[model samples]
Target chain A: MLTLAGVGKRYRRRSVLAALDLALARGEIVGLLGPNGSGKTTTLRIAAGYAWPDSGEVRLAGEVFDPDQATLRARIGYLPERVPLYDPFTVGEYLDFVAAARGLHGPSRASAVARVIAAFELDAVRTRVIGRLSKGFRQRIGLAQALVGEPDVLLLDEPTNGLDPFQILEARRMIRAAARGRGVIFSTHILQEVAALCTRVVYLHEGRLVELAVDGRDAGLEVRLARASLDAVRARVHALDPAIELRSAEALGEDRHRLVFDLGRAGVARAELVRLLAEFADLESVGEATPDIEQALNAALAAQARGAAA
Target chain B: MRGFVTLFARELRHYFVTPIACVVIAVFWAASGFFFSFNALFVAAPDMVSAFHNMSLLLMLMMPLVTMRTLAEERSGDTLELLLTLPVGEAAIVAAKYLALLVILVLMLAGSTLAVIPLALYGTPDYGPILGGYLGVFLLGAAFAAVGLAASSCAANQVVAAVLTWALLLLMWFVDYAAALDGAGGAVRWLQHVSFSVQYLDLIRGVLTRGAVVWFGSVIAVGMVVATQVLRARRA
Candidate 1:
């Protein structure tokens, strides 16, 4: 539903987005993971038509976005990094105003406002002015404004920035629910949120697209074993087959070690590695390493840095 | 048109909910009324013409306070993003704010009309000049509001908006004063004729010429157009 081709943005003398390419299909919830000053917000702003890219183009549903063409704005909903709200307006009134601004009129406007209020679960403080609401409520109201128009594409910058645990879960559920028929591109630094809410992850480092990975179930488990030594166990495993390359062997405690190996390339199987280790030392446990999104992100960033240095 | 109406209503409702609009009107009306009563009742003047002149000055000060928050507050609060992202033209947003300020000016003019009641009751006042005076006040208020809105568009905060607007209004008023000085003739005189307050004074003396109306209308039109351009360029 959204396409960005060779997009770039520069501020002052520094580049924020560098020839970035991104695509979002319908009903896909893509999380943009990046640290500060990584151009995540800049990319989202360019997509929302709030900030124009220095080069290249952004297409929404096959239509090129000319900043002069105001009609295209209706097809996209954006929640800025800092939720800008009129504090004097009540939650209901704010939604009503947003509905009307989106060109919904009469009964349709009323119903749109009502639907968003209910969908975001804002009934409790609907009558209260937004300035008086808690941060969680304010964040919900910001998201509520974006959802008021039911746009085809939603660009949210740090949607769960300042929420409590419960609020974060509620926001995750709401975002997942909205992704049923719409394309969502949410930028966040929270790796856990990406694992929990996003179908795919887009990693950004220093204004460049690093990697895009599909989020999947944890296929590996992690176990800390107490044994004679990781080197002693690894030697026994290597004795089974000289082709096995030990990834890492680190001492945990007194005579305890954490061992990691590349099981895929090894000629021997997991059963063989376990049997050889058991023969050498007392086996504490045998398991797989769990998938870690943070580890993946760090690796991607580290590789990008290395590439830049090279 | 729907978007414009919606934004305009929301701005008007915002004023009613907050104390900014009310405080401006109250302070303006009270201050102007006191000056008028002191000049007319205490000084034993039988006419309210001078009182209208003083009220015009009051508008030069108060109109900025009324319009300072129109766009500057939105920009600072970050709500301008929400407004700009809506499927509405920039002209619609500018026109809506201009209309909202005009409505507030009308209501303020209505409140200031109370000063005319005593003149009508106790003294034999000419209704023609009184009517002309109110019309002049409305036009001057509109022009001031427009200038204030333009300043608000450029400023990032309400305080800066108010200060910039007041400076622009003061320049207009000072232009009229400087035009009347000796030795600066011809072109300067013509420039002074374009002074917003000077043209407004011409209408206050029961002289409602089409030229004066056109001048004020043109000022408002240009101010709003510039404001719209600023908004569009920033987003771009």
Candidate 2:
């Protein structure tokens, strides 16, 4: 398990991460969804104890709070975005190095390396240099290294970034297997991957926490976020504006549900709808209306350009 | 400590698995062999100090090649993140790398000692200066490797690391050139204090002065700390 509390980071004059909080528990595979520069990688880096945050602390397994402690970092396995590797070392050698570096020695180290090689299905290319492998194999090897030490927490940045569909499937399978007894949190831009693999999803926007949703049914959105209950949110919304009509409501789960409004009967303004949803459900993003990340980024960039011209 | 040794082993493996280490060792052996045969090893003074000095200079040239990729390649290749995020401290990472470079230097230095074989067979080779020269060159190699490690820590790539290391070593070579200048002052004294070759020459003269030992020791210590700080800066 891992928890990041009030974590923030700034590079020079640019604020890369605002006050953010995230908690991931064992057996939970959460996907951090965000566009580029959304502080997803920074957050993950801080959680992995690779980067020290300007203001905040990361606690692993609830008790080990100091990121400066080297031994505490052993409980974490991180796969950076680029999947940095020594090209000349073979797959087995690299994994063995990582295992030993994590404090595994002798028979234990060898078995750990062998286990990851088999788990990632890297036995075929175990003897080949990493540089000679294809991109997919390279990604798998990176994953294997992260899985080498069998750490309790896994921090992966864009594990499926450049992989093909088959490779992505294999990666997902590996990630799921890794999460069986550990806390798994990976960042990605793909929506379907989150829907298919994550039991929970956190959305970050402009370096701030935007939404946190739970996929309880393994079908629809079921999450407890905003650190509040659905009934508490509904009561707040009712207090704000009682006349807001709710045509239909469906309870997807105790914490997550769907509410439909009459759009034609009375033109509901976006502001009121947002307020109702914000107060009715502890969700930063509502209605599953986010177009793919590419389109959203384009629109934001276009707006920025227009603003610059003005 | 296990992390350091583990990382050290991996670094040694990296040096050999790539062609760089082999090329450096082979080049050193060939060049030393050529010099011992043609540079009048026995015609000059009885000792092989000059040959040893030349070997020291050769190490100055080859150390940057061995150490350039120690941290620079890690940064460029993104492996530093993977390594740093493990249960290893920044100091440990730097020490492991510098230790690996020292091991490589030992291998090459050991190979170069073969030149003394024919000297013993053909001439009355005094073992005193030879032993002293080996110690001198080995210490000199450590200083060069440390500087190379510091340079590698700051460089963006291996090529840049190599260039910067060469420049640093060259500066150390020439900084104390004016130790005997007419207006000898703070700068000259400073250079004399820091000059790597100055400290190394004492060991070649068969005298292990405290100043010489401290000079090489400081370089090894300060250079490693600088390298560790460079890596630690990333966290900030």
Candidate 3:
């Protein structure tokens, strides 16, 4: 697990991260969602101990991160946004060097190199120099290097950048596999990646933690009873819970109606509503609605804008 | 320490895999050999010591070109981030790079030993002065490599690294020249004391002065320390 408290970084006069606080649990894939220059890379760099923050502390697995501490460094695997790699070295050679640098020696180092090569499906290009490989292969090699030591934490910056659709899916599968036992924190501008790959999402804007949301917790469905018309169903739902705001209502067919409700923190249970509706007419089937991450992200941004104006 | 050796091996491998190291050693060998042969055969010199002296100047110029890519190329290629993020310390990274350049210097200096073969075949070659001259050349190359590495650390581009290293070496070469000028004694004395060629010249003449040895060693140490600081500060 990783925790950041009161973390702030300033370059010259510009503040990159402003008192941002976040905690990622073990086996949880937390996606850092933000636009460009939202301090995503800076946060990851600070967490990886590659860059010293101006203020605040980072704790990984109960130990405070010290820039001079090599033991803590060995517990972290970081894939920078640029994926710095030596072009002339073969894929196996690069991984071997990284493994050695991480202090794995002899047979253990060789075994780690072989394991990551197989895990990333890089056996075909094991002997090929990284410079000759395609962009997708190079990215895979980068990921392979990061995973070589089997660190306790993985910090990846835009791991899916510059990949094709198939490669992206493959990378997602690999990331999910890596997150099975370790704490994984990845940053990206893509919203859908959070829904597909991350269990928790942290939104950053202008160097601050804007919002944190559980991926599937904020969605609910509204069902219209067959005994009532669309308007009647809306009115009945409104009567049951005065706080339920009707978003839209329409008649599907004879005696069947569809109604959408925006529950604003009134905490109305679907079963209770269905049971209450059964008194007036026969209750229809109920299903939960899924809210898009993009919509939630936009709403968060809009709320931040309004708060800034206020 | 193991990390340092691994990094050193990787850097050395990089040098060998690319043509940069080969081209530098080959060109230096060809030029030094030609000059030594011409002075010995055509001019009928009694010894190869003078040839050794002239070869030192060539090393002052060529060592920078060989070492300019050590850190500068890593910066330009964006590989420094990868290196710094590893569990290795800053001193290990600096020492590894320094050792890699030292290996190349040893190979090139060893190549110049072939010039001694002809001298022993025909003329009476003094093994003492030859040994002393080699020690001096090795120290001079080490110092040059350190200075070049420092320049490379400060430079963002390879061309600028090479040029800045050349300028630094040239200044050291002319330190003695400026020391003889009027009213420039203070600045000149400091420069002369740190001059790579001046310290090296004493060793070439078969004189193993402690002051000269310490001077060259200090140059290497100070240069490496500054380079390490630069890397650390940049990461910070």
The best candidate in terms of DockQ: 2
Tens digit of per-residue lDDT, candidate 3, span B89-183:
88889999999999999989888889989888887888998888788778888989999999999998999999999998888777788777788
lDDT of 3 at A17: 93
Clashing pairs in 1: A221-A288
In order of lDDT, best first, we have: 3, 1, 2
- Clashes by residue pair, model 3: none
True contacts kept of 1: 0.88
Give a tens-digit lDDT track for model 2, residues B2-52: 388888888888888888889999999998777766677446643477777
DockQ of each: 0.64, 0.76, 0.69
Ranking by TM-score: 3, 1, 2
Residue-level lDDT tens digits of model 3 in A168-265: 99999999988888889999988878889988888989888865544547665656555655566566767877656544322244434555443433
What are the RMSD figures for all models against the true structure?
Answer: 4.8, 8.1, 4.1
What lDDT would candidate 3 get against the real structure? 0.83
TM-score versus the correct structure, for each prediction: 0.86, 0.83, 0.89
What DockQ would you assign to candidate 2? 0.76
Model 1 per-residue lDDT tens digits across residues A111-186: 9899988998999999998999999889989998898878999999999998899999999998888777999999
Clash tally for model 3: 0
